[model samples]
Target: MLNSEFIATVEGDKVPRKYFDGRGMYIYVQPSGAKYWRLKYRYEGLEKTYAMGVYPRVSLEIAREKTEEAKQLLIQGIDPNEYKKNQGFEIVAREWFENKKDGWKSRHAQVVIDSLEKDVFPYLGARNLSAIRPPELLTIIRRIEKRGASRVAEKVLQRIRAIFRYGIQTGRAKNNPASELTGVIKTQKVQHRKALPIEELPAFIQDVKNYEGMTSTRNAILLMLLTFVRTDELRSATWDEINLEEKVWHIQGDRTKMERPHIVPLSHQAISLLKELPSYPSKGYLFEGRKAGHSISDKTMIHALYRMGYKNKATIHGFRGVASTVLNESRLYSVDVIERQLAHIDGNATRRAYNHAQYLPERETMMQWWADYLDEAQGINQVGIVGRLKGLFSR
Candidate 1:
């Protein structure tokens, strides 16, 4: 048993003596004649303890009040012990980020990791998740924006929102501080860089064939031209998707935007080129690069055009523009037909259904004619351009 009179009279120098109070509480009598109060209790079937106060700072009556409050929580079936354990950021942040990784792209995941390292961890890593506020999050996000990374700043804000949401769900935070932050920060638009024009294409294509360069560089450019698909779609393509005999290239929806198999009707000339490829049968990538199983780098395409003496005027991607320009210029196909073949978003879903494969007959004729024109344009044949283009006229 412990009493205030005994606590007041206790004398100590270094070692402390323990005295149990009623209701699983205790008062420690230090060797220096000081008494510290500690409360021991069980809530929700688990053991827990709370420090009441150091000697003289909290009186015996004050300590009893804290013990009584903790007791009431026990009566309500809540665990104060578990509550204390849950009040940590390290545990919450880990669980939060793990559940979120699947929804992010690889590049996006990298940015989140970088921002947390540079912004959140330094200041908030040690703080309890429940303690963070909107103003606190604004301070961190503003720092990222100050470095001229507005987009990254927005991403950081989103990441913080997710963290706080996790904190709230886990009973660690009261509310998400990152909400209602749109007016606090200004958002900037993201622009995509597009390839150049097509009128100056004949000379550029000629230069590629005759340009002095590595075999891989030249072949990758040529393959990109033949496929006329997104760089990622083409680079990640496998040999299994290509059928030279059938003259068809199938791109599964996982690799495409529409989430449907996009079957590109290969031109006869395209098949001949693939047949001559060094390892079409041996490798996974049809354009297998030197980097293990991964596709060729975009740099290869960029550098190849550089070597071909098209420093700025033309690019590997410019071929698409060239094809579209020539096809539309000659009026060989309707706008809807051309747009569908280009895999552009259709304005009319009904018309798009008519050509699930994008006016295949006309596109085949157009692609073949375009290939023949390229051959003649490169002076591969002795015949003049006029003579070769004659066969391109719609029958």
Candidate 2:
């Protein structure tokens, strides 16, 4: 007899071994340490087994009850396994989800599943796959669009289409209803991040300096202005990525939006600002959060912007736009250099491969110049040497 304690204490070895729970039910332990409860019964004189969930989750009492239920089904000339295999929708959707979820990153996979659960599953999850048609899918999609989430509606359509395609491959469905949704729905206009006008930079910079907030938050904003990197890129930055002596911040490909490793040449101001930042016990994140072992919240910068009266006028991401616009307008750097610095995709694989040192010298010069220009804009330096010299000569 298998009790809860025995079930819990069973150790798995290299070879799989089965311990009988009596009445043809046994717990099979695999070398990987997975325990599965199964019923070994002869159906029409042929031996077969029915999977009765995994251990702990199924528990001893539940497994026994399931075994008893299977015995009753056997008495009536029915197979529980076959009956379960015939079940549709939820089972098949999960089958497809489990098959493909591993390919997506955890966060992306969770979003996909959440979309399905909230939008797709409730409407069509329990329905037989083969029975679903284009009209039914369109109705669901239109309902989503009615709620003003055209993008979400489109994404749901794609997920449903993929699920149906998976169903078709597995003989669970014959046609994809979601395939017919193309051009049936409207797409929302792409909204770029709102940036303060270049003329507003002086006022914005001054306001940021005067803004009464956490010292860390003020430094974060200043760092964003100097670096022009993405909010998350800076938020999740670790101390190892920064070389104070070398004056370079190396961002690995995994952390970048373009999925390519980037080298950011730090300006003198940036290096000084970093040196002045208060160090925490954690040698990990440069910008440590309130909690240990975690970086600052994603909303930290946004909340700062809101507090500074820039809500709806500018966004944390808008700093990238400011850099792109100001750099392009200056015409002091090549488009290639600016775009590469911005980490934009150029579709030139060959150039990207061979040009790891592309414009490093130019970028170092440009970054320093940009920092000096920002200082001048904020009146950190009164006037250029040339202007002062011209004034003296004129007198």
Model 1 agreement with the true structure over 301-328: per-residue lDDT tens digits: 7877766666776655556766776677
* Candidate 2 lDDT score relative to the true structure: 0.80
- Candidate 2 per-residue C-alpha lDDT over 1-395 given as tens digits, one digit per residue, 9 for 90 to 100: 98889889888998999999899999999988899999999888899999887887678998998799789888889887775464456678788889988976453466578788888778877665755678888988889999887767877787888888888888667677788778887867777989977667777888898989877788888988998998878987777788888999998775676667888999999999888877532457778778876668889989988998999999989998988877776778898888878878767898767765568888888888888878877873334533542343454
Please report how far candidate 1 places residue 197 from its true position, in Å: 6.6
The parts of candidate 2 lying over 4 Å away from their true place are: 1-38, 41-50, 53-189, 280-282, 347-357, 380-395
Report the lDDT of model 2 for residue 324.
84
* Candidate 1 weakest lDDT stretch, 10 residues: 386-395
Clashes of each: 3, 0
